[model samples]
Target chain A: MNKTQFSKFVEYLLKNNNVIAPQYNVEAKLIIAELKKTSDFYMGTELPLDSWKWFLLPPKQKMFDYKGEKMTEALPSVKKQIFLGVSILDMQALTLLNQIFEQDPYYQEIKKNTIIIGTSHMPKDNFSEYFAKFEENKLEHLQFDIFLAVQNGGYKIYTGSEDGQRFLDNFKYKDYKHVEYAGPIREEGLDLQMVSVMDGMQNFHDQKIWDDLGKRCISCGKCTIACPTCFCFRMFDKSHLEQGSGERNRCWDSCFYNEFTQVAGVAPSAPKHRLMATTAQKIYFWYEHHFVRTPGTYSLPGCVECGRCTRACPADIDIFQTQRDILAARNKKKEK
Target chain B: MINDYQTHNCKILKVESESSDSKIFTLSLPYKDFSFEAGQYVMASLPGFGEAPFSINSYFNEKKFIQLTIRKVGVLTSEINKKKKGDIIGIRGPYGNSFPIGIAKGKNVLIVAGGIAIEPVRPIILDAVNNPQKYKKVFIFYGCRDESAMLYVKEYPSWKKACDLNVALDNPKSKKYIKGPVTILFDVVNIPTDSIAYVCGPPIMYKFVLAKMLEKGFRPENIFISLERHMDCAQGVCQHCAIGTKYVCKDGPVFSYAELKDFKTWLSPI
Candidate 1:
């Protein structure tokens, strides 16, 4: 691969727009560091626990405001930023997010505004490996506007489509050359044999592992917050003291909460375990099965397998292990 | 062009005290247009204490005004009881689906009513009596807690004159009152398989009548029932009058026994 200096990589991203590089904090956490062309921005070794959605679809984005009887839709415009250092899983997460927010009536406003750039993993410090149980699922290059695959020398660019090609042409890289082939990272295939996880992604719901994990879940909803693809929210209506005007507000919500389905004296999905199991089934098994041929076609955003949910889980429910255990249990159940 | 809401006045033509707590106010509307089929109801909005749906006891053949046989069990009905003569009230609608009178026309109609439930079916009795040739034998079997709870006090003379009427009180042992619960209808009448039965009463009475109907091999579509539950909006939107998927305001304050038989969440509010 024809590679340029990492310093030149910085110059290319800055020329087009503001760039957000994941810089390391003291606690080994990766935070989005706003970088100027001349800024002392050193990308941290680990992928940030956050997905690009904090920019695209924030947890509690106000959709509209209502008072008394008046209502108005909120703006979806955002500043153009080149999000560098995104992993393949992060790219998959964004694709799923686009599908979810773009269906039916279409949250197309968010998609029309943002430009996404995909990157191969390049870590220098403590990094959490997220693809252990998700190796076989190759990141579909079609999802992003631009793809950056990292090798030993430098980054090889692969423009997926017209939008991607135009983006790279505009965001011109200094002292960089295009190569026909992009090689793997220097420490390649260290754990590549466990790639069969692509197959493991399908049978997640009917596998009794859901009920077992769901029973122990405290319904805290920490996993959803830390997740890269959870996009469910609630609409709130507020009124002025005069009772003349009111605004409807948009806020993040968890399916785990009691009130999520507290309308009509009966909830379509109710009780704690049912919600969790159904969520897992809907996201993990249902979406993957329904959309395996054309992923994200119907807007079911499954976990990107980011592995952050495992860390955020106070109940110590490792989604990775839970998924593995589910597979194991299925085999056992089959034998019975 | 007055935008402010106004009340139309109605005279309290007569007051039949239903129970120690309940009463029926037969208000004679001045307008000749006051009409509704059996099993339909009206929303009596009392300006502020809020509007509520009440089953209209329509005796269409005789009555010139709209009559509401209210059980004084709630704030609105209790306030309605205190109203005497020339009382002004606001009313809207003969809302909701009525009892399928055309379907039950030729069938043997076994009419059973308990408590204030007779209010809705009272009109059907009048309509049936007006055209006795349309139906086969019409038998009216009613059981009230006491002699005073039975309504249609003035029409009892004519009701007995026109049809087979069996009225029973809760206590049969007392010479003044016939006793025992009304579960005896299963033995009293020979329910022809082709009979169409109409039942209305308290929740327990409705349930017991359903059991009796089932015991007599009555198909679900052959049985009709009028339901009573708390209702806020007489419109379908408020959702207060929901019984499972069926909106009691629009689909029915009246439904066939078959409709509610399998609806698990009808009264099982979460």
Candidate 2:
């Protein structure tokens, strides 16, 4: 589709369905929001400050509500929406999220009702090499509705799911080839870069790198909020003014917080309860979750190399730099 | 179609005060087919007070009821202590891997528990008690702060009939029980080196107890430890209870020493 035709299609989409796209806010900083007009769409090499997580897994969501000790499951009611101009990195992130929350009802509630339209736009600062370039084979593992491969002046469109083809057909767009939804793993097995970093961070220890990050990190957890894949959460119960009533809620929780690992009790019951005591251990835990644990369990890269965390970090603790340091430490240990 | 976070409403069948700060609440399952193995845990909640994971203290074969021996700790548990018989509470999961009873069959079974940690391992003791021929011999080394802090004391006589039960206390009022940490009982008792040991206790206790077990020639693989961490989701999605790649809620609240030794953080000190 050409740029003019695509604009018409987006306008048609905005008129009919809830369309979400990256647009510049008042300060001219890019963010993902509901698109009201074609003029608001901002598709470029610069990645948006926020990823799609805020849409799928809201920062605060009500899991269940109660009245006089009677519990009722209260999942979010979502409308069918369209995510237009999503980048490949974000697509990989969405794929990881889909697998992680495959069993999660709340997440699935939002995910099933949404249609993702991915683009071939690659951010300049991508650390992971696989996503640095867009190709046909790369589409095999990632889950997306429609993909727009960038051409000279327009886009070469491809459909991932039946929903994508239907969406395109509904818009009266020209026929596009459909890509089958292959599972996450490719013939190469897991990504070697992810494996290297995971091994380096877990097996090979680097105290200095973590200590430096610990010193720099303010523990504000802005990085977690900005990162697309940081999905750790803690549940909280809010009591209403009425005696036995309120709602059970969950919000994004950071490992950097001391309370994240607190098992409540006194003396014998609470002994050895808090896991990460110091700031360094907490900071290391955040990285370990992204670099080690996620990859170890899911057989996919936890981090999409988005670099938004570094952008949002107040203290300039670079994730890519830490990964390099982890690899360096591992190599040094191996040489010995 | 399954909602992993959705909990079933269970009525409290009975409630018994176990100690000063702990209560054993037996719950009637909402579903008839509800069953869980030893070492598995459930996320129990009082509507307005949130939820927390508690180990199922009842035996696996207990058809009608499941007992949770909860220490009054934090907001949720403190509220649960106030619940009465016939009161309703929320419960989800028989989550996490259970103790490998199949492997322990035909072998000597050793159980070491400390303080409130004995709740999770009670099922193993009950299993041995119910089916005496399931294992060769059963030994329990239970330690608490003192005699007043001990749990399930009334059941000791019944437990003694089929198994060798030993008790230890940090401070004993009389000369009746051995005085010291549970690790001290290792010296008093004759542990089969080839026996499979199930150990659950405070994290600090694991350091000393595991060292003694390793010194006693028990293979690291033969010993399984139940880990406790602050957990929100009994499913692995929430990273609260993760140690390395293992989710204490899913892959384990119980893990072989072999799996734990390689953990970089969270399970044990590096």
Candidate 3:
């Protein structure tokens, strides 16, 4: 598809559904938001500061409403929406989220109504190998409706699901090839980087690395907020002023907080009984979640190597450096 | 698939006071088919308060009703303590892996539980009680803070009939119970090295009890432990109950010692 046709396609999407794409926010930082015009689209190397997760998994969402003893399911009421200019790395994150929350009613309600449009725009400092270059074979593994592979002047189009083909057909763009949606597993087995990192974290002991990170990391949880795949949440019930009426809600929660691991029934005045008491332990738990637990469960790379955590860190704790330290610890353990 | 988070309404059929702090609540299920294995837990909730995980104390064969032995610990449990018979509440799941009863089938069974942790293993004891010939022998070593904190006192006489039952308390008012912690019972009773042991207790208790169990020649694979964590979503999406790579909510509230020993951070202060 040419630039003119892409612009027309964007216009068509906007007219039919909510068209959200990468655009500059009020602070001149790139973010994913609803676009008013075709000129608002930002197609470039620089990735948005915030990921597209906020749209699918909001910061706070109501699960159900309860009146006294009865509960009514609170499914999201979302119109058909198109996510345009999503980078390959972000697509990986979204795909992982899809798998994790497959049985989730709240997430599935919004996910079914959403369409993802991916771009061939590769960021300069990406760490993952699979998504460094956009390949046709990689198209099947990723969960995207449509993909735009950048050519010299315009773009090469590929359709992942039947929904993508239907959208393309409606726009009379029949030149696109349909890539069958294979499951998230790669043919070559698990991602080697994830395997190595998970081994290093699980098999190897690295107290010094975690202690250093603890000293540096303020535990502001900015990294979790910035990360596209950090989907840990906490649920609570808020009672209205009226008698016996309330809404049960869930909000995005970070492992950095002490309350995350605090045992449920401990009294207020009593000393808190938690899993990770020290700051270093909390930091280790966060890394373990991304590098080890996720890969162990899904056999997919948990960290997309987005490096958003590094960017968001107040104490300048670089994730790449931490990975190196973990590997070093692993090697040291092997030598012993 | 149905929404995993959505809870089923259950009415309290009977509430038996176990102690000053805990109560055993028998709940009538909204649906008749609800069943759970030993060591698995349910998310109990009061509409205006919140939800917390409690191990199902009743036997799995009890189809019409399930029982939860709850200790008043915090906001949710404190509210639950206020609930009486005929009151309505919400519950979801039957979640997590159960204790390895299949492995304990023909083998001798040893159960060690501390304080309120006895709730999870109660199902195992009840199972053994019903099928006395299934195992060669059954032994229960229970420990509590004091005499008043002991659970299922009325069932002890019947339990002692088919199995060897021992009780240890921090402070005992009667000579019938031994003195000291639950770990002390390990020294009091001669545990068969080949017996399958199931332990449930606080983090500190695991350190001593596991050491004693290992010293007694119980293999790591043959010993199972039920871990407690602050869980929100028992479905594993919530990170509250994560210990290492495993979600205690989903992967286990129960795990073999072999699986747990490999975790660098399975319990705090490791």
* Top-scoring candidate (DockQ): 3
Residue pair clashes in candidate 3:
A265-B73
**What global local distance difference test value does model 3 have?**
0.88
Query: Across residues A1-336, which tens digit of lDDT does each residue of candidate 1 receive?
Result: 244444665676677677776665668666666665534554433667665767666555544444322234555566666666666667767765655454311145556655566676533331224443323224332366566666567666665456656655555643333332222211243222122232333332244554555566777878767777665555444545655454434456654555443321111233221211334332232223222312222322245556777778888987667656655654655567
Question: Relative to the true interface, what fraction of contacts does candidate 3 keep?
Answer: 0.71
TM-score for the first chain in candidate 1 comes to 0.70
Worst 10 residues of 3 chain A by lDDT: A264-273
Pairs that collide in candidate 2 are: none
Per-residue accuracy of model 2 over B1-270 as CA lDDT, tens digit each: 677777788999999999778899999985679999999999998777788899999988989899999887677778788899999888988899998888999999899999999999999999998999999999999989988888998888889987899989999999999989898888999888899999999878888999999999999999999999889998888898888878898999999998888886745433
Tell me, per candidate, how large a share of the native contacts it keeps: 0.00, 0.72, 0.71
Q: Model 1 chain B — which ten-residue stretch has the worst lDDT?
A: B1-10
Q: Each candidate's chain A: what TM-score?
A: 0.70, 0.96, 0.97
In model 2 chain A, where is the ten-residue run with the lowest total lDDT? A264-273
